[model samples]
Target: MENSSPLVLMLLGAALMLCLHPLQAQIDGTGLFHDYYAKSCPKAEEIIKSIVEKAVKKEARMAASLLRMHFHDCFVKGCDASILLDDTSNFTGEKTANPNRNSVRGFDVVDNIKAALEKACPGVVSCADIVTVAARDSVVLSGGPSWIVPLGRRDSRGASLQGANQNIPAPNSTHQTLETKFKLKGLDVVDLVVLSGGHTIGLSRCTSFKQRLYNLTGNGKPDPTVDQGYLKQLTTLCPQTGTDDNQTTPLDLVSPTKFDTHYFKNLESGKGLLITDEILYSTKGSKTAALVKFYASHSQAFFQQFAKSMIKMGNITPLIKPSGEIRKNCRKMN
Candidate 1:
């Protein structure tokens, strides 16, 4: 295989090119531009994930909430500036208490970055901006996204749990359904496939896969081609029974530990473990083969586009100042 590092760097460089696009990124009122997401600082996103993983492990419901936020933000408007709080409740509802989990307090990671920035630039940035920045940063850490994004956009007061519930896509949605839903948010097939890479870092509860593992009546269950040994292990661990949501599975196939092109590789190998993942390749007209080849022949190619898509996602039309209010808490408002 071609050396991976140079290719990835080239992809990253291209992603950073977006900052220099005609949009004119504003950094401290100066016309000068910087490739914000070009390199480094994606650790903030990883920190949030680390926290979220803990949250999920500690409490699924709460972890689900954070997961919902990440997905909602990423899918709706291309991970735009609006996902984090910036406005007051547009609708009202009962507030549910969040169970104890570290990631639920995503602020932990955001705050760290804020503190670092404050020392470096002192109030030149906003938490709202930090959260978005951290997201792109996290993508890079996960071996994706390299585009620079705008900063200084203030936070909002709106972060509704119910809205999140309504916006996030389900695990079992078909390609037609998923494509339609993603389109409503201005996303495309490529964005959907790439962002789904988030699965690389998270876990899937047995509840999400039980139907695929056991209840299928026809070809609904595991494919006949799956390794018999692997098939037996799944049965032994998840055994079609009561409340098996406790079992977890990794989303990445090769080098699951490192967030790389392995996920695409997995799809090529028919090792996509999730029903949603399996669809990526099995679905007709998908770029699965192309993405896999591109990443292998040019691993950086994936990250570059992934990064550009991420910045595009983050730029989603946010309800901004004078148009929205800052939510005291992220869970609910209305």
Candidate 2:
């Protein structure tokens, strides 16, 4: 009741929430599993980033793989631990885009972790766990989702390319559309706003967002009030020329590779990198805007909500108990 002590009520509510969602019961490893997963994620991310760092260094095409994996999985059936597979079973490409995002070479760093874990723990850890840990670490490493959840979410043995395509929102989707999609995943409108914080890293091809500068007019373009100089920069980077330029911008312009409040500020300042990013502040997503306000005002609040959302998102139809096997290789059926 509103009349009850807020602190006592808060404890009661959290206890109820944990009871209703028994995933917390899975964290009985004295935090060792949590620590192991957290510690290993950086190592995996260093490898993934080292690969991307080369692209930054050589001005080469950045591998869209690691980020691609997260988007593909989360969008499909609410991050259902399926994208960690390289085989074709349990899912179909027509339903998800897992295959398309499966750029083997880019995930070599994660592969390194699997191999190391294989030696250190030998089949104790799953590729699903790898992707889950990698997703969080990837966020921290490249600048997004700051907390780490448990790593015992076992790897599944099926990869569904169609699943990715069906679930992942097209870069140009409207804020209203994205909210519905996230809602279907058991996440609220605010979850989509926060989950998309993944955009803080990675690059989107011109084809994905070019509709703004070259086509859309007036408010159809993101932040219609956004500076013309900035618009011109994206056009130049993307090039309307015969060839496509992969001109990518950091979603969080301030600390492109660090997870922070810059994303919320960007939305308020009209500097969100993608059309979808900016739309959350628009009419269709005023609630999302409210969340941005909360996140900006209370850092701890945002982190806590973000962590819970990650857990909810990760638990979608998980390969619970003995439901699936951990694949030996993430690229193909073993």
Candidate 3:
């Protein structure tokens, strides 16, 4: 046979990868069902909801933290709970990654839910599924739309610190960067916009968006996309020297405690906290800009899309059947 063309080789390589990682096709919920745990652990989601409800009642921000944990966990390694791993002698965990360290919280909440599930139905529920359920419950508790989460995800045996750092979109990521990051995860522009709405309730540390307040583009100027009034407030809260990294501000200043369309409204008014958030609106002629506007005007549309997108996100490359283990401790390999 004649030598294969470069295009043919590329197509063959893509096909081979799909065969090797068949779970990648599951992002659309191919092998997953909404009640995958109904028989194995009937009370699995209920247990998670109870714990998350109490936690959020005690501290409302916990809802956002839990939601963020799910996002971080999924983006790094296909929602496999690699972000939940703790550093060990043999491996460094994703927890220490630049995007996650001091940012992603709610591991204890996951632990609490896992312990409850273990008591109720030992070894039946996976920590990965626990995080997924907690995320759904967190949204519902925080006044966001809820969806039936498909289960049967298993925990990975390894962590990917590098993947966490490189894959998770940073607070300073550009519009193109955010789009590419979501696309790499089998998500689309709509997914990116709707998922970003999760920011409507979360708290972002000063470190996450200090550049927008201080030295954007190393020019020693605030991001012009930021509202001048909001910039003044941010400068007062976050200093020009940028020392208070641990200090947090709500990602959505309009209605920080509620998971609503205010985040898109903030973007429209140049009040978005992070460059990544603001760019969704400021990126001229971008599809994301249009989506932001649409969501801002029609919250019902945003809520519906958010629920659908979240389900799609939860389905990212789950390890089914005998592929991964049901971890006893979410932070350690089984």
Candidate number achieving the greatest lDDT relative to the actual structure: 3
Instruction: Tell me how far the alpha carbon of residue 146 in candidate 1 is from the true structure, in angstroms, after superposition.
Output: 3.3
Per-model TM against the reference:
0.65, 0.72, 0.90
Per-residue CA lDDT of model 3 for 1-334, tens digit only, reads 1599989999999998766543553555556666677687888888889999999999999999999899998987787888899998888989899988877899899999989999999988888888988989988988989888877888999878889889999888888889899999999999999999999997988888887787899988879888999999888888867376788889999888898999999999999999999999999999999999999999889989999999889888887878889898998987
Error of 3 at 55 (Å): 0.4
lDDT of 2 by residue, 1-334 (tens): 8689989999999999756443454554211234434443445434434544544344322223454465566555434446554435444532224235323224555566677666655555666666665565555444344665554455555545555665667767777778877877777876787777655455556666677776665454444744477677777787666764455556566666555677777767766677888777654448887877677667666667776777667666555446566566655445
The C-alpha stretches of model 2 lying farther than 4 A from their native spots are 1-68, 77-81, 87-106, 142-148, 217-225
The segments of candidate 3 whose C-alpha lies over 4 angstroms from its true place after superposition are 1-29
Better lDDT candidate (1, 3):
3
lDDT for 125 (candidate 3): 89
Over 4 Å off in model 1, which ranges? 1-69, 74-107, 111-124, 143-145, 217-220, 223-229, 285-297, 325-334
Q: Largest TM-score belongs to which candidate?
A: 3
